[model samples]
Target: MSKILNEFLSSNLQELKDNGLYNEINVVRGANGPVIDIDGKELINLSSNNYLGLATDETLKQAAKDTIDSHGVGAGAVRTINGTLDVHVELEETLAEFKGTEAAVAFQSGFNCNMAAIQAVMNKEDAILSDELNHASIIDGCRLSRAKIIRVNHSDMDDLRQKAKEATESGQYKKVMYITDGVFSMDGDVAKLPEIVEIAKEFDLITYVDDAHGSGVMGKGAGTVKHFGLEKEVDIQMGTLSKAIGVVGGYIAGTKELADYLKVAARPFLFSTSLTPGDTKAINEAVKMLMASTELHDQLWENGDYLKKGLKSLGFNIGNSETPITPCIIGDEKTTQAFSKRLMEEGVYAKSIVFPTVPRGTGRVRNMPTAAHTKEMLDEALEIYEKVGKELNVIS
Candidate 1:
């Protein structure tokens, strides 16, 4: 053991603990459904990103079992060296169709998806204009690319346009790409992609939208780009199979040239083993299900509206969420965490998000109402929220 390493970790961890920022992960005993069992207590789960309740769906479970029985668990080798299976190809094709893209490439995770796609195309000579509030994965990906990064104000079109114009006119880079999240995870606000595309057109810039939270919840399960009918306009559309699709993996949907380029050039694809057969098959089945029906999508929106209305009527500040994600702003970090703790004790399991995940003094308990949540479950959670809110002086 290294003494320096030990001291560094200990000091940082102590700082986190002293600042009310230490995260203690809970153990979910079984499937991550609407109701989850944690340490012998079943709680109405509002923390999961299982937007459409497909994580523990019986059909997806069967699909996974069948694929595992047929193809084993691992991909056996890196994709560049025969790891690519038939199901992987099928998944890529299905994802392309689902995303309305000409071709697609699958990755091990959403984080890697951004890393691979960004670095694969953009390099040290390029400049990336990224949304300030984009996901951590995108931030890390841009860093990995070694590009001249410019941070645009969150959802500010004029800022993006001005910066883009400067970057394009300065003649300092070979390419300029604007990257943003289709729907921000923490705040639940939808990105203004149409304005982004307009800016791209004005400057001939590349466009990338990481629609991790929007895949199954927006555009009738197609995505944000499709919702705006910009399938041909946006250059790259990245999505995850874990969140709403309720499996695990990520993919980039775009033209065949881009897909082919990534297939050969992306480091993760060239160096890392591909997604497992079971996960691939499960993702394929989930995408098919999403394309086949809008039942779950509609139900998800209904639950969101119901929960938002309930929170608002109780005088809680739920932010401007265009999707099903709801955040009850609690302001102070300790109070926000205490509110979440009380909710858990009262049989609800929403998590408190504070800095540096969000801005300081804007701590919140983020609620994610899935399609699997019953009306009774939401009602019960709301009742507990009311009681806790009044007790904590968060509501009158």
Candidate 2:
């Protein structure tokens, strides 16, 4: 490395470590499930995004194995090249059917889905009204679009309406788009889509919903757009197969025209290699399973409610989460990190999320209680949380 690079890294590293902002990522020894082994200790895991527990499901595993035996591993090249396999088409078809869209296009990851979709449609000549608490990927994608970005206060329809009116009336741009997450990942609050749809209609703004966290957690596992029954109104619906679907990849479900445009225009889809045949097959299987039954989704909600009630009863500041994602807010960064550490040591592996991931002085231990978590496991995790909370003086 260059000397200048070395000095820059050393100073930033020291500052983060000194202020308790540095994160130490633990290694999971095996399959990520309700229980995980880290550092030779088994802990009740509350950190994974595998909301439906399909990551280790026998059906999904068998689908992957069967595909690998026949199709081998990789997709050979980019989708724009010769990489479009039959399984790829099938997966996209499944996604569209699941999301109640006319067509869909898949990407390498959830992050790339935002990167690809936003830039493919919007340009610098346009303006974007974005939610203040939107995910980092959506923020970066908006930046990449070169659009004039307006930050709308989190879930404030009034702020969005004013921004939309200003952008559209100013005539400073050709198109004004509104982008938001279907579910705010950090806070677990669902988006106000009905009001958003009405405002978008009034302003003629192109609407985009990044439903990465909402994909399998909302709409009976279809997604947030479906949950609100706005399947025909939202312009673009983006989601991930990685989370509740418990596989790997992202997709944009929309009209046939949008899918066709993205297939030719999106840089990630044109340049990056396609998803593996096995992963595509497995994702298709998972989506089909969800569409067939809501057993897993129901269990996920039941567990979320259980954990939220348990934490709140102990005097922990579990924020106003509307989903299975429960956040135990600890104001100071150092204390939040220590609380998570104590929980891990006590055999519950919930991680601390701090600044740049969340705002300063609002550090939290985010718990994702999946369908895989048994009542027994949740009770044990709650017991551990109570012990750690009192020991740290986080609860009375």
Give lDDT per model, in order. Answer: 0.94, 0.95
Please provide, for model 1 over 1-396, each residue's C-alpha lDDT reduced to its tens digit, 9 standing for 90 to 100. Answer: 799999999999999877777777999999999999999999999999999999988898898899999999999999989899999999999999999999999999999999999999999999999999999999999999999999999999999999999999999999999999999998899999888899899999999999999999999999999999999999999999999999998999999999999999899989998999998999999999998999999999999999999999999999899889999999998899899999999999999999999998999999999999999999999999999999999999
- Clash number by candidate, in order: 0, 0
| Collision pairs in model 1 | none
lDDT for position 174 in model 1: 99
* Cα RMSD (angstroms) for every candidate in the order listed: 0.8, 0.6
Model 2 RMSD, rounded to 1 decimal: 0.6
Tens-digit lDDT string for candidate 2 (1-396): 999999999999999988889999899999999999998999999999999999999999999999999998999999988999999999999999999999999999999999999999999999999999999999999999999999999999999999999999998999999999999889899999999999999999999999999998899999999999999999999999899999999999999999999999999999999999999999999999999999999999999999999999999998999999999999899999999999999999999999989999999999999999999999999999999999999998
Flag regions of model 1 displaced more than 4 Å. none
What is residue 355's positional error in candidate 2, in angstroms? Answer: 0.2
